[model samples]
Target: MPSGSVALSARPEIIGGPPPGAATLEARDACAWFGDRLVLEGVDLVMPKGKVTALIGPSGCGKSTFLRLLNRMHELIPGAALDGEILLDGNDIYAVGTRAQQVRMRIGMVFQKPNPFPAMSIRENVLAGLKLARLKCDDKDTLVEQSLLRAGLWKEVRDRLDSPGGALSGGQQQRLCIARSLAVYPNVLLMDEPCSALDPTSTRRVEETIDELRGEVTVVIVTHNMQQAHRVSDLCAFFLAEENQPGFVVEQGDTLEMFSSPRDPRTLDYVEGRFG
Candidate 1:
């Protein structure tokens, strides 16, 4: 058996879902282009507000590109253009006068590598987003505690809040990055292979953190690890691209059904290791 097995939790993510009615992100006919080449096309996906949705596929399948579009990061690239609507609770994020910065704050992202400011202390790293977002936060200490606790790092690093973020182990730094994202109180969290670099032990801890975050925040993750997807995601979206075609979601459904009995033969092949 693989060492990356996730330990199951007994708790439901939360008591229903997001406050009153908020945050059901949807992609409507979303397409992305880099220069003249199209990477993703005609993609439509609904990410439930309080569930974890995993995007999985072979490399170069545009999973990461689609993930970046949620927060408008794809627009940063030179010659990159996106057409179609990415809606947050019925509001089109790409609509006129919608600030990308606010969109990013509402929908935060964590990269594959743990990138904490090397010179800043751990607590400072957690609080860094406030400065960039130019928002003042009262209850500073409480925010730090709450953020670290949510990331599952408070117990281990509680005594060393003043220590440099770079001083922690790779996994701990990743968690600190996660805490930084959570501190903003984003409605949706985007993780791009957040645990791909860690050792087995650290990976499991990060997976636990992801599981714990389900009810409190919306999570959209792009990962190549089928086992991890099955272990952590509530919904699984399988993306694929033919030799010269733009990538699109081939199938999406409950994680269990996707792994146990996928509708597409290609999905079954990829999950069963028959082909990528």
Candidate 2:
């Protein structure tokens, strides 16, 4: 929304204000802790209206934690507490008026492992979110069709919507999860290591889906695969942690610059494979 100022070079320009009707979500000096252990401290970032921002770091670096915080999922964990603000469309999600269910509806998530509801059919899984949201009225078929198509899974499973979601292949299942997230039509989609368990071919398909889904929803992914980050993200944020320390953001910039001309030496080392 701000002009003439660039945050991450690889990040697409914000253009004008909130993409002509897009919601504005931002995290300002946000901090999270589980009991006495801090995970993220004073983390500040923005999820541009309809762009993908990838969070990358080695294991235990809090990338997943950050993802959870975006949608208030962190608070669901026992003993977890949060401070500061997570603003959705300029309203703090932590505000009393903001309920957890409401926050999740606006910021849907996909997991590292495909956890399709085993009891639910493909069609049921896709509509699960809306069902929870209590959304009603016309065009149920149209919404399901568009959601599946948008997830790039329609042609493969169009005629078998009644089949169990677990009956799908690993890749199809992941796409099914994507469709599930899309059903709610969230303003942002958080994916945590979404392709980690898939094969190369499956990863490619999911990445392609991500590329296609851009401008339709804001996406934030946490991944250990640097190449995947480069291939799929518009912006990149690097995280790190040391002994006795919680993970913190080391550097964040455009994927191109972070991979090529990183401003931090640690980022350069990690990207160059000198360190994890």
On lDDT, the candidate that comes out on top is 1
Error (Å) of candidate 1 at residue 93 is 1.0
* TM-score computed on alpha carbons, candidate 1: 0.92
- Give TM-scores for every candidate, taking all chains together and pairing residue i with residue i: 0.92, 0.90
**Candidate 1 residue runs with Cα over 4 Å from true position:** 1-22
User: Clash pairs of candidate 1?
Assistant: none
The TM-score, computed over Cα atoms with residue i paired to residue i, of candidate 2 is 0.90
Query: How displaced is residue 91 in candidate 1, in Å?
Result: 0.9
Tens-digit per-residue lDDT, 120-220, candidate 2: 99999988877777765255676677678767788898898999999899989998999888766677889999999999988998888888777667899
lDDT of 1 by residue, 1-276 (tens): 122221212111222212221267999999999999999999999999879999999998999999999999999999999999999989999999989988888888999999999999999999898778876665678778777877889999999999999999999999999999877777899999998998989999988988887766789998888999999999999999999999999999999999999999999999998877
Q: Which ten contiguous residues of candidate 1 have the minimum total lDDT? A: 4-13
Worst 10 residues of 2 by lDDT: 1-10
